[model samples]
Structure formats: C-alpha cells, structure tokens
Target: MEITIISAQGLKKLSFFTHNLQPFIQLTTTPPGAHRSHVYTTTVDHEGGVNPTWGDKFDLSNIIDPSEFFYNKCSCIYLYLYTNRVLLGPRLLGWCGIPVADFVDGMASVGTVRWLSYRLRKKDGSKGHGVVNVMVKLDSSVFRKKGGSDVRWLPEVNVGRVAIGIPVRTLPVVNYIIYYKTIK
Candidate 1:
C-alpha cells in the first residue's frame, strides 16, 4: 500500500524568533494497546518555508499486516507533523490518525484526492495552535479489482458553495464532516 502527502496549509509557526519551521510527516500504524508499530517519514520541506508543500509519496508494503488490517481490527494510520529546526530541534505541531479501513471500504476511489483536516495535538494529547490541512491520495494498489461492491458514501457535492449560492464553477471547495455515535 502507498500514500502521498500532497501539500499542507494553515500551519502555525512554532517559534516567534524563527519563521523557519521545516515540517515533515511521520506515518505509522497505532494498533490498540500495542507497544510499537512501523513508522515512515517524508523528506523535510525546506524550500517552501512556512506552510511548505511536499509532493512526497511513500509506500507501506512492509508497515502493515494484511490480515489484521483487512479486518479493521488494528488498521489505524497515525500521522504526526513535526518541524525540524537547526537550534531548537524537533517540535510537534499536531497529529491525527485515520483508520485504514476507512478507505479500504471504498469510501474513496483510487486516485481521488481527499482534503482532510485534522486537529493538531501535542504529545500530551492537548490542543495545539493550528489545524493541518493535508491532501492525501491512497495508491490504486490497495483497492480491490473487478468487484461488485456498492459505493457506501454519498455523491460528491460542493457544500461550501452550495450553501452560499456560489456557482460550482466559481468555487470548487468542499467541506467534509464526520459524526460519531456511541453504541452501547
């Protein structure tokens, strides 16, 4: 399986003294109650400076177990965004984790780019200063081929423009929301 870190927006500056926050992503799987998991990272975005853009693509052929991940038992992918500074060292900006099963269920088609926004959390799980916007693409290799599966998600809609009466051609922005309900 492969995933791409397309770009990031609305990043907060960690240090006021230096505007040079070199950011990169650390991808790993966090199985519930597990002590450790496999991790990978993209090259630091040094050129784009703050709010850097890295079209980095990484493959997780060795990271996950096929049997466990397929069953949605231990398939969480944790993404941690960090800034590697020269003097101050690495600082955690925020982190978010999504279930690999979320995509494997065909919620998103192959080659589709989903703009996901996750809340920034510190090492202690407290709120951070900024929100990270990431454009992610799961490679086609993960999708099952030639299946008669029905799409469970709704049709793509430009909700932002629809509510404000803006034409779809003029504004092609979409807002996605996920709701959670506890089942006893």
Candidate 2:
C-alpha cells in the first residue's frame, strides 16, 4: 500500500507565547502481532505555521507484509504531529490513528484513490486542534502474478455516483482533473 502525508490544518502551538510552529508528521505502521513498528517522516514546514502541506509519499510494499497488514483487524497507521524546536528538541503536538479498515475498501476497489481526513488527538485521547489529510491507494502489482508482466490497473470513474460539494466558489473549476501521477 502507498500512503501520502498530504497536509494538516489548524494546528495549535505547544506554548502559549509561541508564534511560529515548525510542524512535521511521523507515520508509523505496525502489523498485527508485530513487536516493533516501522516509522517514516516528512520534512518540516517552516512557513506554513498553522497549516502545513507535505506531499511526502511512503511505500510500505517492502517493509510490511500485505496479507498480515491488510487483513488484520487490529492494524492501524499511526500519525504523530510534532513541532521542531532547536533548543528543546521535537515536541509532540498531537496524534491520530487511521484504521486499515477505513481504506481497505478503496484498496479492494482496484486502483481507486481515496481521500480522507482525521482529527488529531492528545496523548490522553482527547480531541486536539488539527486535522490531517491523506491520499491512499493499493499498488496494482500486489494483485498480479509474480512471473507475469506488470499490469497497471486504470481507475474506473463512476460518474452517476459522484457528488460535487462546493464549499468555496472563488476558485475556477477544471473538468476531469487528474489527481494522481505514477512516479517511476
């Protein structure tokens, strides 16, 4: 599975007097029955402050076993938000868990790209200040034969079931915008 840490919004500063929050995100995934989790991180966004965007992509195909990580009900992708402070080191802002079941349907949909948002939570599991957005898709190679030629599955667009929600109207709309591009 491929996961992208797209962006975060409305983050709260750790200190009352702090003006700038240099935010970054850490993604951790632990397969069911595994003793240790694999961790990946995005670069710190110095200018975004309250709202940061990082198009960092992590490929779990090599690190995790698909059968164990995807089918296990207890598996979760943990997201931790932190602020980098030169003198004090990194401080945890908040964290959230994205259950594998949430996107398992999209993965089964065969190359479907799913967009999701999750609210951050404090260490005690209370509601935190920010929301994190991510894009997820299962690699097509996972569904094919090992010795056969690589086959890429194209995403099916279901126009009848699509609903457009316009929260903001100031921006110009582009028809049939392509959201995902395969690298390599």
Candidate 3:
C-alpha cells in the first residue's frame, strides 16, 4: 500500500494517447469485485472516475480523500510501463523510465505478468498466507474496451484462465477492459 509515481507528462501534458498504466498496489482500504456502484470511497474520482472520456479529465479527487476506497481490492500494480518503455523503480527506472519525447509515437514495450495463486476463505473459517485485502491492479492504460483495439489491450501477462474487466458485469462502456487479476 505504498504506490507513488504520479507526475508524468511531456507529450503536451498528455490529454489522451497513453500506452501503459497497470500500476496498482492499492489499499487506502475496500476491493473485492467492486461495483455496487463501487462505493467505499477514497474519492477515486467519486470512487470510480465519475463519467470521463476522450481526454479523460484527470480527477481522482485530490489523491483519494480521507483514504478508504477499498471496494473489491486485490490488485498489486506491477506493469510498470511498456509500449516503448517505462519500467520505473527497483533499478533506478528501467526501460529508460520515460523519455521517448514523452510517448505517442510508435509505442511498444510490453512486460507481461501473472502470479496469482490467491486463497483466503475467511468469513470466520480463517485461513491464509496473505490477503489483508485491497490491491486493485488493472492494466491497459486505464481500462479500455469499448471500441476495443487500441492494439487490443496487449498483455498476455501469463494467461490464467479467464479474466477481463475486473470480473465485470454490465458492458457497452466508454472504455474499460485492461485486465489485471487478484482476489482473496
């Protein structure tokens, strides 16, 4: 629950034209299958980036208010960045860590992932190795799958079985399907 790295801009402050953004390690708390209109609150743009599109006007509400938006937690952020490069942290920044004129040229650098083995049958039965809850690690430059094909959400991370849109329900979204996985 210590993810920080916001303040990346260059291609004219990027209004729209992203490549990667699977950065999760959430837990400001909530996180399960989120979507009860996904309440819980950390202000994540009204718990979920209230109505946005195109140049998706950034507004995650001043970095999660009061801290407590853990609706369906289980993401752990680790795609760093790829699509030309941006691996960040643990190596003084990898893939060159942002500097291709700020991205938006050809874009190509996938890092693929998958290591889920979750297990936590708790209601009282209590059994675990680790699953304190709240992780939320999504992929594909911030979920996108309406018109699909922004290169078709490139992320064969490691292929599990079936996963898309954080265990979604309804569809016809504006853009949403950057798959990430985890749930205890």
Candidate 4:
C-alpha cells in the first residue's frame, strides 16, 4: 500500500509565542499481531501556516499485511499533526485514525487514485480544527494474475437490493429495481 500526504487545512495554532505554525504530519501503522509500529514523517511546511501541503509519498508495504490489514476491524493508519519546535520538542496539535476499510473500495477500482480527507481529533477524541487530505493506492502486485494465467481474480463482494421509485400523475406509481448479485 502507498499513501501520499497531500496537505492539511484549518489547523489550530498550538504555540503561545508564535501564531505561525510550522507543521508536519507523522503516520504510524501497526500490522495485526505485530509488536512494533512503522512510522513515517513528512517535511515541515514553514510557509503554509494554517494550511500546509507536503505531497510526500510513503510505501507502507513494510508494515502492512494485506490479509490482516484489510480484514481486521482494529487495523488503522494513525495520523498525527505536529508543530516542530527548536527546543521544546514536537508538540502534537491533533490526530486521527483512518481505518483500513476506507481503502477497500479503492481496491475494486483498481488503478484509480482516490483522495480522502479526515477531520483531525484532539487528544481527548473530540473533533479538532484541522482536516488532513491523503491519497491512497493499493499496489498493482496485489492484483496479479492467479495460477500464472492472464485472468486476474477480484475480491468477493456482497450487495443488497436497491429500489428506485418514480411518481407519476397518470400512473400513480412506477418502480425501477436493480439487484446486485454477490460476486465471489
């Protein structure tokens, strides 16, 4: 899996001395059953202040177990927004956890780049002032042909019935129904 840290918006200034925020993002993820988490950091954006853009891409293959990450309900990619301080150390401004399930839909839309934004949260889990934008892509290798054949296997899908209703003055009512079959 690969993720691009595009930017953040509406970030609150956490420092008392300066309103100018030199913010950067740190991403961490721990695979199911793994003892340690993998961490990646982005370069600080000095000029962006309340809105910062990094556009940094990181490969998370090292920490991701496709089967576990995509299936485990507890799997999440944690994002922490921080302001770099010369002497006081990095201070956490806000953070959020993005569940791996958020990327599952993109897997079915193979070769498509999807950008998602999540609201940042305070230390106490309250909604914070910033939103983080990121682009996620599943590696192509994940969809390689099985059994050395040209045919590629797709993930199984289960869908329910959807009904559309149309109201007509003359006919009273008309219904259009579409049913999606479960793909295995």
Candidate 2 residue spans exceeding 4 A from truth: 31-36, 144-184
Better of 1 and 4 by lDDT: 4
Number of backbone-clashing residue pairs for each candidate, in the order shown: 0, 0, 20, 0
lDDT of each: 0.64, 0.78, 0.25, 0.78
Tens digits of lDDT, candidate 3, 1-184: 1222222221111125433332222222122333322122121211111121111122232333211222212222221111122443321011111111112112243322211222322223344222212212223433233344454432223322345556656777597679878898
lDDT at 38 for candidate 4?
A: 67
2 or 3, greater by TM-score = 2
lDDT of 1 by residue, 80-170 (tens): 8888978668877777776554445434665765656666677777776556555556554444332434333322322131166655566
Question: Candidate 4, residues 1-184: lDDT per residue as tens digits?
Answer: 7899999999888757776899998888843234545679999999999999999999987777665566555678988889988788898888888876577653665566779999999878888899999998877654554234353534443333346898546855779999999999
Off by over 4 Å in 4: 30-36, 144-184
Mark the regions of model 3 whose C-alpha exceeds 4 Å error after superposition.
1-35, 38-111, 128-184
TM-score of each: 0.62, 0.72, 0.17, 0.73
TM-score of candidate 3 against the unseen true structure: 0.17
Q: On a 0 to 100 scale, what is the lDDT of residue 144 in model 3?
A: 35
TM-score winner between 1 and 2, please give it: 2
Error of 3 at 37 (Å): 3.4
- Per-residue CA lDDT of model 2 for 1-184, tens digit only, reads 7889999999988778888999999888843234645678899999999899999999878765654565566668888899999889998899888876676654544667899899999877899999999998777654544466665332322323335886665878788966998999
Cα error of candidate 4 at position 29, Å: 1.0
Better of 1 and 3 by TM-score: 1
